[model samples]
Target: MRRIITVEEHFDFPDSQTIPEQTEPENDAHVNPKGNDPALVTTLLANFDQKLAYMDQYGISLQVLSDPNAVASTITDKQKAVASAQRTNDHLAQKIAQYPGRFAGLAVLPLIDPEAAAEELHRSVTELGFKGALIGGVPFGHFLDEPQYLPIFEAAEKLEVPIYLHPGMPSKAQRELLYESPSYSDSLAGMLGSAGWGWHAEQGVQMIRLIAAGIFDRFPNLHLVSGHWGEMVPNFLERLDEFIGKIPTPLERKFSDYYRQNVFVTASGMFTKPQMQLAVTEMGADHVLWAEDFPFLRRKQQVTDFLEAADLTDKQKDQIAFQNSQKLFGLAK
Candidate 1:
């Protein structure tokens, strides 16, 4: 059974270290990698507070967050890195506990090392009682699909916690490949372009690797969710199946089967009706959930449009809003 889940969201650290203001030129090849301008974030959080209060008029619950400043450079080493991540999550968990009605929390993880991430996951869930982890779109130096990070996936499998892949500026190597001229063009790719594309491409690529590499097959219960209706799953299911079937040799199982069993996606930034229908048809109503990019103050249109657009049964709508999340958080049946 699916229930309602409204994910109140916030972003990880932004492009450069300048919080709330731009010190240098916006150009110069994107100094602040994450694009979360601090001054902007502060103003937005205030707006988020107002919006959260306003949502009550419409009967929505806000799932709050204390995401780590995932700007890789900011959180550099051991003492400053892991401990700060834990402290932030611990604080957010405390906040959520205070307003149990309007809250559930996601941990912003520092995935510098696999063991470090494993330790933090345990602490966030067992001690501080976080709902799950939110990883930036790409790990600092590696893509989520890279085989080097299997131990991290193994840990999530053991913990039975979901990880949300929020967007971030892409790694240097990634930006170089997609655009014709990194020297002339920008990684920002017009501000929000590459981050959006990266999330979509990265999720699809990683999910394929997880399925193809036999990670999901090995850890059947490991729950993974990404932002933007899984980027491409909604529209590309048939093509994925067809390609896999046509080239089925090394892969042990059908491509469609893995998606049906292992993946979940959120309505965090996607606000289109066509996309909503495609997501429901491919991923199933139960597999899709809602997320409000809280501190960004993205706007109310997504909230209203998603509620109206999804081809959800009443039970499914309930799940997308609340219960689906409950299950992911170990809070539901």
Candidate 2:
């Protein structure tokens, strides 16, 4: 069997730092009231040893762990956000130290302050030895394309680290316009505005916003990683190029060119062959990475089965399974 390196696995902040009210429903079965899967909650809160057992069972060799909630980004208070981010990264680094070869870390930045965020990214990489950073969603209702956030991108480029853009909860206006309705239950509406559709769509739009705002042109060598099969971007690249391509811009390359050059995508629990094929076809094998979105999708058999069954050559499979991540994050074999 090939060595598997999964990127997109997540860990939450220690309970002391977590605010119960702000915690998302998906992470708690009791709060969700709809998807009441206690097993998932258990898995999410599982210990490092427990996580390793599951990974061992599933043939996952190394997991690049991150904070799923992007906790610091959502914190409105600057001091609290910075402190939380430091605490979170410190906790993750301590955990990674315990199991040296079994785990790697992606820092969670306090994007509430872009300058502070850059400094934290630098600290996490230089001091904690984290592979990269993960920015969950729009902070303060602003996309990363905004000028205020340029420091974060610039820091990332200088550090030679990638930022994993993960899905975040939608805002109130978004819910009302696209998901909320009198016809549906609150839970159903919430689902519609979250994982079911909204999250992926929002992430896809953020990617476009970054491109249109000239983020790539400014920081040409900046690297980014997107989850959930490129947040639906891979499937729509041609359509994006077709429509956005004609728009006048100061971009040096086509919209798709930036994607191919600067972005990498991971499976992030979407394990079907068709999705895998689409990502590979659009992004190439070298640009793809494997991820199980652990704790949420804890099907040991399914993870191993999908990669084994996929119609890919040995080299291609190796690249997707681990090589791509090793190259991207400087992971050891």
Candidate 3:
């Protein structure tokens, strides 16, 4: 098996321990509502021993760690948010130090303070050796393309690290509007809001908003990563192109060109071979990276087996599994 590097894997901060473990649905289930196995959540929330053991068993060489959910994105007060982010970044730096070779990290920035966030990004990449930052979507109902967030994009471009835009929990109105079905209860609705359906829609829209706002044209070197198969964006490439032609924008290139150049999508535990085929065809193989979405979509054996059985040639498979991530994040083989 080729050495694999999984980027979307998560671990919680020590502060999360103060919060009690969440109750899952009453029905005995294998994977919990958040797409985590209860047993794996225990392991994920615990120290790194189980993770290392699992990685050793599965041939995963490196894992880029970030929090399962972000603290800074939710906090509105700039001082509080920046303080929280610095603490988180410092904690993450220590974790990576414990097992530097087997681990790297993506820092969590205080979106409320883009200038501070940029400084932290520089410290994370240059001082702490973090690969990039992972942002949970939309802070204070504000999207990334908004002018206030320009510093974050500029910092990412300057630092040469991708911003992994992971999904955050959506607002109640947004959830109710999009995911309220007749049969499901509040729990299932909340699940859909986070992982099942809403995440893909939200992140995909966020990507489109950046393109429409011409953020790519303004910060041409900025790179962003979206998990869960480009939040289903590649599948809509033709339609996006069609719409881009109709709308006027400051961007010199079509939306698809910006997408193809500036965005990198990951499988992020959605290991379906067909989805991989579609993404590779639309976005190109080099723009796709592989991740297990660990602890949440915790199925390493299944993921490894699926990749091995995938129809792509060995080299292409390598690119999806590790080579592309290696190139993007500057990981060594």
Candidate 4:
């Protein structure tokens, strides 16, 4: 059996005490305090470590995303935030260093300036010994499809590394765009609940932007993978194709053609046999990878059970289960 490499998963940076308590107190209705409870991703990792040690149970290891640092939080100064990201990346790299087979690092580029982001990408890959770059699906209201940020894409292409577009908070002042819906309701749960809802929706829009902006045309070799099973875009791909075809554009091709060409999707939290089947339907087994969002949910057994029960050929199961990710991450063995 081939080893697996799970990309497109994230771990948020821990906040220093000096950052001040920016969290809004809950209505007592909300259990977790905003800005203070810490992101669940890393908490999951810590739990995973405990389980592995005591339970004698293990599953595939993850190349956890260490980007998407609190740079999005308003309290963070861009320069200071980038410095913090550097510190976190260095720390994460060391952790990976301790267990070479168990972990790998991803860089959090300073995104306020595109040129700086490009330079960081070069440093992360060229100097820090990291695998690839992780950018928020929409960086500061600028989608990855924007031409101004071509240098980042160009550098990733030049280095032939994957770009993991993990979801994060959109730029401030952009909140109004999300204000029109029920997602806009105030209160921590309602506000963040709505925003969490917005994350997947916004990501789907970003994927469409990538297609419409001809980004794939310029960087054909670039590998772009999304979390949460392409963030629900697969279910609506047909409508996307129809809209694009009717818009009087010169580029006439199936939307799936572009999707299958440049995109890969990970089955992280929403993994089940039927949904995993839907993921394969659009992305194919080669482009879809299995994942267990450890700790926050249950351990590796949930994922193992799904894989064991999936109705796929042994070879197909092998690809989705492990082989494809190894090939995608250049861990082909």
Which model scores highest in lDDT?
2
lDDT of each: 0.62, 0.83, 0.79, 0.63
Q: Give candidate 1's whole-model lDDT.
A: 0.62
TM-score of 3: 0.91
- Candidate 3 on 138-203: residue-level lDDT in tens? 666788888988988898998889999887666667877876778877777766776677767888
- Write the residue-wise lDDT of candidate 2 on 1-333 in tens digits: 889889988787754765633533232121241135855655554488889888888788999999857567667678888888898899989989999799999998887789999999999999999999998867667888889999999999999999999887767678768887899787777777887888888888898899888898999989999998899888888888898767877888888999988999999988987889999999999999999888766657777778878999989988998899998998887
**Candidate 2 segments exceeding 4 Å error:** 15-35, 39-43
| Per-prediction TM-score to the true structure, in the order listed | 0.80, 0.93, 0.91, 0.80
| Model 4 TM-score, all chains together | 0.80
Error of 1 at 154 (Å): 2.5
**Per-residue alpha-carbon lDDT of candidate 4 for residues 45-115, written as tens digits (9 for 90 to 100):** 44435533422354555455444434422233566556655666666676666655666567777666667
Judge candidate 3 at residue 103 and give its lDDT: 85
Worst ten in a row by lDDT for model 3 = 22-31
Candidate 4: list runs displaced more than 4 Å: 1-4, 15-56, 70-78, 170-196, 250-253
Question: What is candidate 4's CA lDDT for residue 162?
Answer: 80
Rank all candidate structures by their TM-score, best first, as comma-separated numbers: 2, 3, 4, 1
Give per-candidate clash totals: 23, 0, 0, 0
- Candidate 1's C-alpha runs over 4 A off are 1-4, 11-40, 46-51, 64-76, 180-188, 192-196, 248-250, 301-305, 309-311
| Deviation in Å, model 2, residue 167 alpha carbon | 0.4
